[model samples]
Target chain A: MFTGLCAFPLTPFKDEQFDPVAFARIINNLTDAKVDAICAMGSTGLYPYLNNDERRTVAENAVALADGIPVMAGIGALRTRDVLHNADIVQRAGVNAVLLAPMSYHHLHDEEVYALYEKVTANLSVPLCVYENPNATNFTFSDELYQAISRLPNVAAVKIPGMPFGDKVQGEQRLARLRELVPDSLSIGVSADKFGVAGMRAGCDAWHSVLAGLFPKTVQCLIQAVRDGQGESAAMASDRLSPIWQLFVQSKGGLRVMATAADILGVCEGNCLPHPLKPLTGPARQELEAQLTSLQLD
Target chain B: MFTGLCAFPLTPFKDEQFDPVAFARIINNLTDAKVDAICAMGSTGLYPYLNNDERRTVAENAVALADGIPVMAGIGALRTRDVLHNADIVQRAGVNAVLLAPMSYHHLHDEEVYALYEKVTANLSVPLCVYENPNATNFTFSDELYQAISRLPNVAAVKIPGMPFGDKVQGEQRLARLRELVPDSLSIGVSADKFGVAGMRAGCDAWHSVLAGLFPKTVQCLIQAVRDGQGESAAMASDRLSPIWQLFVQSKGGLRVMATAADILGVCEGNCLPHPLKPLTGPARQELEAQLTSLQLD
Candidate 1:
């Protein structure tokens, strides 16, 4: 029954190690701000870059430090075995549901794809959500596939990526089609941070969000506005957050931008990313500060 | 100094474990076929999909099995610490050169990027090669940046990507410019397998190759033609292999198609990949077989 704004918090690191103290504070802030859910080890959390020990630590600390809020941990990898291994580790650490996306270097067959979810759901003791982010996974589940996966006993939710990196699904139609096809018991959430207002307004059960981690009030208010169907006010909030979305777009899908916004707002320390990825620099860094000041996230 | 046709073998996995026997066969085949170098853990080797233990094992096995061929190991990760950690493991395994790629989740600045190579190079008793594949790393090096990295104490070569995903740097000019700008002592190599003839004829000191792993005789033949500046024969050989290149292009940057090619030829059994990725399927599978038959690499 996962719903409302599912916050994806950025994993704060210090000295190239997962800093539990700093990360716990970020989780504490989001939970205190009263968001719907706190998700760690997401794309924003740099899950694929982490070692298993670090992932376990992040999941354990995020759940333990999130106070009473539901913590959904992403447990995806390039292989079914590794994905399950991470799922087992996180489930023991007490996450509500493990979010998954099957990432691969080659194109997968439809049957092979179906068997992956079947294998995971068959063994997972807890509920697991399907994260359909094609940009990273290169997989776009057909209507038939979605319907089939929904029947799996432990399937909890389906998170549709808001950023349409490829494939045809977009905007209101995507949410409508998913809501219609997937089993009603599964939560339907939108993950493109910039599109949260519109995604929520479109009747997505939740926003699997990155924005909420940086600007909780703005995102929480957007969630409430959409719930109330306050279209105009929600649009206004979307407009104000437009600058933030623009920065994410410029930075190529929001990780660096979110880190910059979080760093500027004193939400975290050290703008350094896990290397190869520096914090937003040059023009984009300047624009982030400008957007924060304008939106009053500063 | 690593030069000439460097073969990058695909990592074969069985039961989700690295199959050293299958990989050892591929390494022996390439060395026996007389490639200039045997590179383990390159992108073609599926390094990122591997665990550190698997990576170290592959590096050690490739080096020990390479016979007299120099072994270059790819030691890149999303973090500087991990890259160096991998470098240490690979260096102790007796690889000739460690190939460093600055892969990132965030955009990096030039100075920080330069420092990554410097750090890894400084710590090594042996040499390192700069792998500038922007499609994966998302970091584009300037002409100035290339010259700077080339001057590092242990920097041996710069492998520029032959497949231009975007921003257009595909042919002879790319090799010619880099050869002119990079330090004369530093080897200049082209990484696109399809363009071996053109890349070598364009003055690339080496072809860091995937084709050589499976079709070593054809690649070796092409290398000789180009080295002899027998341009017409090299072009003819590349033309016969054009269908093979077409399969790679259809598969998008060639890993799956090459893997399928190797698998079909019985270069290794259990043509398995890390998951999410399956073997080439449908029309592409048929075409791969036809191309192999035509090239006689079958």
Candidate 2:
């Protein structure tokens, strides 16, 4: 089962090309920070925007740069065939596990969605995680779907969106409810910056994080605090990073805010292509800088 | 404004490779049958299942073999950037126009959906058709969405699923409503095998078809009858093809039953990957063959 903090790094581009060197630097830092697993080509990484070759470059480079850290590559596409093909490429690239999102161009029914995972895993011999990001996929997995998917081969974990933004009861209670539904062998991870500590407290095996990619110190501290059941330090870390989490919520993690944060902390260059959200600039940059200084990112 | 019988062609495969020769044969036959515009890489072509290179091959081969006929290539993906990239490739491949389905992996709001078209068209110099396959996208185009999208540059047409399977009143009233809302320049089409004559009778500007991909003679005849308001002949054509249409309805166009019809009619080998629906096997093929013989596909 996949566990601990999984860092999802941004795919930084340079000179209108996928800069493998720039991406490598970010992977090295995440590894240096002792992140358990590095997740590449996630929603945060803007997987859909990158071309096929760029995606391959990002995955291969991430694996090579990571110093023994298991790399979990996002391998979701509109078709099951493409996802399967992506899994094969990433596996060949030496990723430890693939985070598979059941992405679709159509409103897929439960059976069709389940069959997608089945067909994909039929070709997959490596470890896989079911990426249940409802915000991205528009379809939430029922406990039944989760149970069926868990029975699929090599399903090491299931990463659900942390807190399911805007739901009234938006904390550990939701994660706890999820834990009760899945099998004991199937690991669960949460995918929101705000809910990292709360997620660990709620029995999540890992924190599949976007913010942790940039500011690993706080995330690692938060993960430790929750593991020790020290609510105060967990609260402290969450409070310290509240501003960035707010930015993520507001911007939908599209802009290169996380990349900018990494750049500010001397991790990697903060550049992205096909900018889906407003990049941190002017006032936003100043605010992020002030927050980073206060936190002392190193 | 692409009008009349727009024959969408099947992407045939041989030795698990996209058979350009087989695909070209189907395209030639459609042109011979006098289809106005031959739309390649349509849903009938089993598009999403194909890889990036495979998709490129299908579009390019369709254009090269179309014999001077206007080709409308389907260009839809999980991201706006990818769509723009695909539009460039298909345009470079020499397609006249692109049929774009605003396919999303996420639940996109109206503004986000509108912005997708804006961003895509900003990169495109070619004509674009909005393929609002609600069943596929999960988001229906409201009159507000339609008006906003219509104002975007180069949006020439909109294709909505006709009969909206299982809606109590499965008729042309919705098409009339769509027509009343859209601008005069924006052509409206329906995507249902059963709705062709009725859609034309109900004043659909075009027929975005699946059956036309194979049996062009019947489709062209249906189109002409509808144009001349020959409801009786239209009914006869619809009646003649009802068994096949029934199968399409049952399968939701996943089985490539149309491709099977192409095979039955000796157009091209009817084979598809990642079959979304049940294939024409056992009793289904026998039933289809009897129906095809009655229509006399020669």
Candidate 3:
């Protein structure tokens, strides 16, 4: 009975240090929005940037903030050992589930991909959500591979990044096929909150939202509209949310954008994306400000 | 002065675990061949499959085995954090240098690529080698990016896969230009031990060998012939080694093939490549055996 929006919390950093206080405030804000589940240390949460200890701390804090709502921990890496290590940390922290990307440098055949899921499921005590973020992983699970993995024990759901901006039709077709393949008990989650209404109309079970981390009420309203078959209201909310998504996506890197948005919303004091990603460009910030105003989000 | 042959030790695994004893023995065998230096845990060592602790152990054992000879640790990953973590571990283990690959993701612009090297170099205490293994990384460092990274304080060298295998003249020309752009102190290392004599003739400072992990003596002999300016002897040695190289290349996945050959050489007890690479086929074994016999490597 998972309804409403799921928040993918941004991990806060101050002067290259993990800011638990700032992170706590961000998670507390998401809880105030009443997000159904909190997804911690995912791509949006900058999972890859954090060390094992940092990841454990973030997972524990996120679970505490949710106050009994499920906290799905993202625990995938190029190496299986590292993934296992992360899973152990999350499981010990008592998270609800593990979200994993089947990512590796080696070209994975279908059997290899299946084996990865089988191995992870065998080791993990918590329910697992197989994340199908092909852009990050560089490998897409075949429909056949997905079907096999979904049948594995403790695999509670599938997280699909529903159609990016242009590939709506293909994305919709994939979602439909996935829905038919997965059993009725297993949920199908969409990270494309902007298209949550369209994806829900196409048969998605859950809306996993990055935007919900910032604007929980608006996203919850949009989700409620979709659940209640109020397509017009849902579409209107999505239109208002589109500008914010565009602003974040244009800010060089996803983590930086997420942290900046968190800062702007007053959820966190300052944004600190680790090294390599520079601070926002002048034009990019101006564009972000204009978009926020246009959507009446400021 | 590093030149001629560079041996990458077989990362020994016992009971499906990283065995420092077996690794030390393999390193000892290479040292006996008077190999220039050991590139520990590079691609040939199955870098992607090893965990941080395993990587650290391998580096420490490599240093101990080298016994005053240089040990260059391979530190490459899709995530910048993992790469930095591995670099710090290797540096602490007292390896002479670090070898790095570009970030493993698609559509990475030149600036992003440059930033990766810059960040890694800033933290690394030892010398660094910029690895350009396009076959593995999928992303090739441009001459412009390579030139910029080569100028960093700790960047001592650049490793490029030897002469374009597919007769891509443009690639060869680019390599030639890259050689010109890199500082003279920054040595250019080449892979492809079979035609390494040719690579030496083409102006590379040293030949990086995966096959050397299997037959260090044969590889050392070939490199010595090349260094001594005995072209005919070097060509003869290459001809003798060609069959083994073909077998190594033909054994299923490229890295797996090398690992399997390492198994046969008793360098590592059986091949245990992580998910995605299956064991070698029956025909591959037959081919490997015949090639080993023909090369009189038995």
First chain TM-score for all predictions? 0.93, 0.91, 0.91
- Residue B133, candidate 3: how far off, in angstroms? 4.2
lDDT of 2 by residue, B113-150 (tens): 78778888777778888887766666677788887888
Candidate 3 residue-wise lDDT at A194: 58
Q: Residue-wise lDDT of candidate 3 within B150-241, one digit each (tens)?
A: 99889988778775522335445655787788887888887866556666656678788887765778777776676788867777777776
For candidate 2, the TM-score of chain A alone versus the native chain A is 0.91
* Model 1 per-residue lDDT tens digits across residues B1-298: 4678888888888767888878877887887788878888888888777777888898889878988888888888767888888988888888888888776544556877897887777899888888887766667899999988888899888888765412224565666677778777888887877767777777678888888877678788888887787977887778787787877776666678877776787766746566655678779888888767766871
Candidate 1 TM-score over all chains jointly: 0.91
- Between prediction 2 and prediction 3, the one with superior DockQ is 3
Q: Which window of ten consecutive residues has the lowest lDDT sum in model 1 chain B? A: B163-172
Candidate 3: residue B139 Cα off by (Å): 5.1
Best by TM-score: 1
Best by DockQ: 1
TM-score of chain A of 1: 0.93
Q: What is the TM-score of each candidate against the true structure?
A: 0.91, 0.75, 0.84
What is model 1's DockQ versus the real complex?
0.39
Q: Which residue pairs collide, candidate 3?
A: none
